[model samples]
Target: MENSQNQKQYWKENIRLLFILLSIWFLVSFGAGILWVEELNAIRLGGFKLGFWFAQQGSIYVFVILIFIYVKLMNKLDKKYGYDD
Candidate 1:
């Protein structure tokens, strides 16, 4: 039925968006927060240290902002892809 096809398209779009969002999340959190922490630590943002901020707070804020950005972008993408309901 048309409904089932629409549901499948929705799921596909969601999966694609999820992967992209999670990849960015991992890169910012793990890569910037842990792996490259030392190099980043040398850099400073105002009074707070870069590495510490990324690990403790910055990554989380980035993730939240990214979620909103993803939603906005995905909505536009879905419309362009003809996947919007």
Candidate 2:
């Protein structure tokens, strides 16, 4: 019974982490790239319009970074839950 509860808590935390990371990815990719593109376009980065850069490349870069972050976070979470090898 205690083990069952622990598993539930661990699963809950894992889901929570997933939600947070995915939310950030969505906001960066969809919000900045599409919804706020015009506002972002006013700024420049590396000679390219910030909005255009986000639409074309920034989101991908952010996603990749988020992947690494998720992996690191999950590793910690696993260790905490005694799931790590």
Candidate 3:
């Protein structure tokens, strides 16, 4: 029973992490790229419009970075739950 409860808690935390990460990805990809493109376009980055950059390369870069962050967070979570082996 205790093991089952532990598993439930672990799964809950994992889902929470996934939700948070995915929300960030969605906000960056959809919000900045599409919704706020005009506002972002007013700013320049590396000779490119910030909005265009986010639409093209920025989201991809952020996704990759988020992947790394998720991995690191999951590692810590695993250790916390005694699943790091």
How many clashing residue pairs appear in each of the predictions shown?
0, 0, 0
What's the residue-level lDDT of 11 in candidate 2? 98
Candidate closest to the true structure, highest TM-score = 2
* Ranking, lDDT, top scorer first: 3, 2, 1
Candidate 2 deviant stretches above 4 angstroms: none
Q: List runs of model 1 lying over 4 Å from the truth.
A: 1-20
TM-score of each: 0.69, 0.93, 0.90
* Comparing 1 and 3 on lDDT, the stronger one: 3
Error of 2 at 55 (Å): 0.8
C-alpha positional error of residue 50 in candidate 1 after TM-score superposition, expressed in Å: 0.6
Kindly indicate the candidate among 1 and 2 with the higher TM-score: 2
Clash count in backbone of candidate 3: 0
| Model 1 per-residue lDDT at 61 | 96
Say what the RMSD of model 1 is: 3.1
